[model samples]
Target chain A: MENSPKIAANPEKYTFILFVSGMSVKSGHAIENLRSICDTYLKGNFNLQIIDITTDRQSAVDYQIIAIPTLIKTGPGQPRTLLGDLSDTEKVLRILDIKS
Target chain B: MFNYFHKKNQTGVRKIKPSKPQDEKFSFPKTPTGVEGLDEITDGGFPKGRPTLICGGAGCGKTLLSMQFLIKGITDFSEHGVFMSFEEPSKDLSLNVKSLGFDLDKLKAEKKLVVDYVRVERSEIEETGEYDLEGLFIRLNHAIDSVNAKRVVLDTIESLFAGLDNQAILRAELRRLFHWLKEKGVTAIITGERGEATLTRQGLEEYVSDCVIILDHRVIEQVSTRRLRIIKYRGSTHGTNEYPFLIDEDGISVLPITSLKLNNEVSSELVSTGVPGLDTMFVGGGFYRGSNILISGTAGTAKTTIACYFANEQCKKHEKTVFFAFEESPQQLIRNMKSIGIDLEKHIDKGLLQIHASRPSLNGLELHLLTLRKLIKDFKPTTVILDPISNLITVGNENEVRSMLVRLIDMLKANNITALFTSLNKQNDNLRPDLAEESVSSLVDTWITVRDMEGIGERNRGIFIVKSRGMGHSNQVREFVIGSKGIELLDVEFGPEGILTGAARKSNQLQRTVKAMKLQSDLDRKDREIDRKRKVLEANIAALKNEFESVVEELGILKATEDLHSKIMIENTPKTKKK
Candidate 1:
């Protein structure tokens, strides 16, 4: 409804957190880039929790994320899950059900 | 309200069928601003044929940049342009830009450019019941069509905003204006005075949100420097840097401070900076032809002397060179350097070196860079010298100076030209001044500092290499001397005390005190002479007083004799008065 350049006025719906390993040579780049995309598109709506499983192997198991690189939608009502580094935004959007 | 409801009820309504949404693609020609740094930052000139919303504060070079944008499009890009001025007339625009070598009126006559001045004086017109901007639109269209304009600039929209006050009509007209620009499919610039964080006074950000560029002219430390920043571009990959820009007789040329590249390839060819001793400091005894050397020191600390020696070396090496003197004129500089035996005149005569001396204040920093750009392009010299770049900071702020240096260094490096810069530091306690221009220091391949060291009885000049990137250079601070023959690199004098600063002459008071004591002894003899003169004056005063008393006594006796005579006469007169 609001038309300011910063038009994402609604932030209460989603809390998405993205976890990252660090800016390393291999796996870190994927995590870092994914963080920027989430921040840019989701803005305040989605909080990105990027847990670096490369460092803390226990956290992945603790969150029941068995896959090495996995994204678990921890919100209520049929929490859809996805695998891989979240590179493909379309597939990620389908998994997260983000409106265009 | 009841009458409207009854009328609607009497009419009754039927739902119309919904139409399918259509996706229509349209293409618009984009006209690049051609404002130097702007095009680089925006990544290849602004989208040609699209209207860019350039808004910023007053005195931010809005009108000037817009005009330059149009002028460059005409002159450089071979594109036709239409300039619609809401501020000044066509004559003023031409006059104002004539200094820039942009013959606006000539271009107009040549049918390459067209300018229409919409003198929107509020007093000239009477308001009608319902009006439109068709007249203004027609005028703009006529101007555009006449030139077959590929570029158009609306100097300012606020002038019309002030002339008209009907909010509804103004809003509708402004929207129509932007849409009409897109409809024309011509690249255009609609400049507005920025209000708050919004794009324009009318809040046209949402309306023309396709692209936004902001121009800012800030006076940091009393020096006005311009910077252009791109806020948004709908579909473009652009560098986001608030780059320093300059306005001069030419036009707005921005200094692209940081180009995104990390190619640090060191050249193999050893180029001497004309000074053999200084060259010996580097491991290779020279610099990569394009290396930047910073010779910094306090006044008379030999910053310029060191740089002259370097320039002299290049000429000796038979390299074609240009020295951009920021401080002294060519003749004066040559004379001073001649005293030190650098003899730049020889190089000038040989046509091996070119001395282009100018006051940094003569033009803005970017203009200086641009003139350098032009000179470099034409001369294609292998070596260049910016004698005392610190002077540039006076015309522009520190940041501007730094950015200018960055771009200059990049240009020199990209061309593989050896560059030397002299800096006169003011009362710097630290070996380095802010060298906030230090940001460019990293970009430089070599950093040299000439400082004054205090020896026991005198000050000696010392030159040291602070850093030379990708090459091993001398770490030792070598004492140096400038003499009639030329500059000689004195070995670093090592004693119990570390180093003596140069120009420490006449600093010790021991010799001064000895001279003062000798003067005091001479003054003591003068004091005796003053005493004799005081006694003589006292004696003369005493003698004159005694003489005066004696004369008084003599006068008293004479008065007694006169009184006796007067008494006799008075007795005789008194008898007559009684009758």
Candidate 2:
């Protein structure tokens, strides 16, 4: 997966797992917003795994998720979690340690 | 903890039907809350493998009760539990129960318990579309699975409403969550905020859980009391009264007032009242060993003296005794009893007596009873004495005092401990009887009335046995004296005037003595006159005999002269005639 041209260009890899409640409007919006931010800021240097908590409940629990549509940045230093629909893009980037 | 859950498949579909009244075939198993008196009212405990709703206002011990349930489940029942708090963080929760001797950190370290804090910030969350509490479910499930918990607590579940604006979705998700907990076969406690009109603020009680318990904190007459009541239980018969509960350093303890039955074991042994004369007034020397005694009287009529005597008697027997002096301090009670020839300090020094002296106004009546219960349990006393229960009447109303005393007496009787209670009757209302005496009279087995009988220019103390069940006792009122030598019952004086006491008794004795002396003098005079008459008759008889003897002597001389004239030849015949 790392051999793709988009991921091979950058040495700094940001790994994230976004837990969502199925395909609800809020979960879908949170996933889209997080992907857009990653694509715009990281320039294909990040690895994001989207998990539907309704189906993959174990992964959600393993991350101690408490709110639906929660985004967790697990790599590149300390882990940080942002709850809700990820509507505040600036706060999300700051929490994920994304350089503007 | 993890290893135990590995043996059972996590995906097993065990459907838990919401218990219905008509479902006679299935009985919900109880989970023993392990609270002191809670299990008795809950019919062993909350419904097992079902969600029980506990709703109350703020500061009503909703969180403390849940914490105690979890801690007791882990320590007493050996059942692991998970505490998921939505209000206080895990650190605050642990620190709060530390005063109750619950080491939550140690339990978590031992893997027997798990504490998870779920923070739901209203500012951080924006609900835009349809969503579920799947994230909460996963977190709770993980916590439970980590400890293989048999009990689960969600403290303040209504806090989610504060963070989410979608009430319809929140309600639906909450219903699913309760059902899921039951399906998992774990006893769960879900606490909620009380509503103004409904049982829960968010109408959470509509979910039809297995049980619903409501806690209330109210201040009546400037005294605060916490009460617990079971709003509904699906399958079990439980106490329906609002039981008073206490939250102290030992956590929450519900006082089951009427839970005691009349089937406690009874003993036929008798215990002395410490006064020898008083013992004879009782049929079997004294009262029954486990029976309750009531000493009701007016002021300064020796009610406390009697109670102190009973306590002294118990302690002298090497039995533990606890004396609750509500009106006096320990030093004052000891000193007062010392003046009455009863040395209570010795028993206290020997460790056989425990004096708990406090003002009745210091706390509510329920707290006093709880304190007595705790002391009795710790000391294991064989005898308990409450000096002047009338003082307690100041703290509570008539009904509360009656209920408290009834529970107190019942507890003592159940433990087979002898109890003595003193009550003070008013001076003017002595003939009418006091309220305390009238209320507690029926509960006690022996009723001793001590009153002041004022007669003949002095006040005298009189004691009488009003009632003694199962034994014959003295029916006559005996006047008693209380001095530095202690109490002594004088014999019943039966004079023409009635029962005499004080100066009347002394005057009656004096009158009887004077009458006896006068009668003795009259008898002596009559005996002298009779003696003189008999002497005179004897002298008259002596004179008559002397005269008759002289006549007989003359006749004998004449006959001898004639006989001598012819006696020459008839000497032999004269001798024969003389013979």
Candidate 3:
């Protein structure tokens, strides 16, 4: 809700959906890493939705998720996917086309 | 470590139990793949509940083969399957196989199959940190559970290597994946791209070690052939030879060339050789029911005519016959045979005969053999004829042709179907059997050779039996004429210049008739002379008898006169004499 004003000001909305398979360490780390990056860099200008594929497998299939802790960055640019736990924040931001 | 957490996650998910017990794993059980001729080669099918590596080059039908396995599994065995394609999406995969009559959507709707296409694009993803392929595991688990699948196909799983970057993680994951599939108790097929040196580009053969099959497509002399060979199979004996396979409208069919053992059942029955004279040459009056007959001859020696006669005879007996003509087209053969009074078209219409004609160069020797095999399987004919198998030599060398014929004859013999093959020998090699004839002569049960016996300024066709196994046969050469009615064998004519035929035989008959007429006239003249002589002698004898009688009467008169004069003295003398 706090990122609403920024979301309207910036027409390029960073829509991110993270697909994970359960409450595993990698999934938790990936979710935390993606949130921290969005809050710090795109503050109030991004929308993030986390999906647990173990519970909602249809979405995992819809996103074509193969590796766990996968973050798909859609809208504002070409849709790109970041595999693994998103531990390398700099590389993820670069691949997602986010300017620091 | 990550492995410990993986174990906990797996246990927490569903308390999964491996399908087979540890001790029972040694007992090999197979799930039959419904592909024709495949089960026989594999000794059964893929090792059940384990992964099989199918490595092949591009466009060699690797994906199609795996798709068939999955579809056939569901349709034929009533076993559910999960197809995880790593290259093509589900829709494209379905469309690609639609022509093959695999109704993937219907199977999916019926809850008998699940198609999960795992699209991996390198440009779309960036590897950040250490990642386990737990997502793939979960998705596969979900699909398997949804369909309750007993079969799984990960077509071209080697694509994962190009999608991911970290070698260590991918290797560990692939190793685990095969193990997981085995633990899941589902028969799985993992396809891989052929490598230059190794069986698979990623060395997937190292991971899935239970069974490995290599599919190859090689083009030689502009003719392409697809072959399949089993590199290794644990716990079971399998055909190790490279078996040629075909991909047609029906799908892939592997032709397992040799049945290996010569244990086919034999039949004592006999089938007519179509030519009545040719049949008489054999003591059995015909060829053995399941025997292989070879008719080797020079060109224009009535070899095809003889073959047509045999085919006509079979059709007359209401037996199914298949004639594979390599030199002539079907219409041409039917027309040519019609000249010899053989009606092949009628038999074709009646569905009792099938004339499959193709140029020997149309396909590779293996393809021709496979086509013949498929025809025999579908038609289930009681008799098969290959007119002029010598034409096949143009497509392959002598050894290849001989081997193909061996397999073909073996197949026919095993099924108790009588087969006949006509071979054309070169004109120069008239004295001895040529390469083609000698190669096949030993394999045939009966060999009949038709040759041109050159006579004085003319040539005559001589038909004789070279060999007839298990039966007595005439050794004399019989003259055969290809007339409008059919092939007719004439009686053996022995003349001063050996066996005569054609014009020589006719002229010999004429000379014998002339000689007999002259001798009969001479005998009639001698009989007249003897009659004349007998008449003259009888006349003379009558005259002599008259003369003798007259003389005897005179003598008796003289004796009477003397007796009268001497009667007085004779009476006295007689009394004295009597005293």
Give the best candidate by TM-score. 3
Best by lDDT: 3
Give me the runs in candidate 2 sitting further than 4 Å from their true place.
A1-17, A21-29, A36-64, A72-100, B1-27, B519-579
lDDT (10s digit) by residue, model 1, range B16-117: 111112234232224566676676677677766667788899888888888888888888888898998888888988998888888987888899998877
Candidate 2 residue pairs that clash: none
Off by over 4 Å in 1: A1-100, B1-29, B75-78, B264-266, B297-299, B356-368, B389-402, B424-441, B449-453, B462-479, B490-579
lDDT of 2 by residue, B196-279 (tens): 989998876534467899999988777777899998886677899999999887988889996356998899999999975899
DockQ (CA atoms), all models: 0.01, 0.28, 0.74
- Rank candidates, DockQ, best first: 3, 2, 1
- lDDT per residue as tens, model 3, A1-100: 5445545666787898988877899988998888888888787677888999899988877788889889888878688888988889889878987666
What is the TM-score ranking, best to worst?
A: 3, 2, 1
Q: What is the C-alpha lDDT of each candidate?
A: 0.70, 0.84, 0.86
Clashes of each: 35, 0, 1
Real interface contacts reproduced by model 1, as a fraction: 0.00
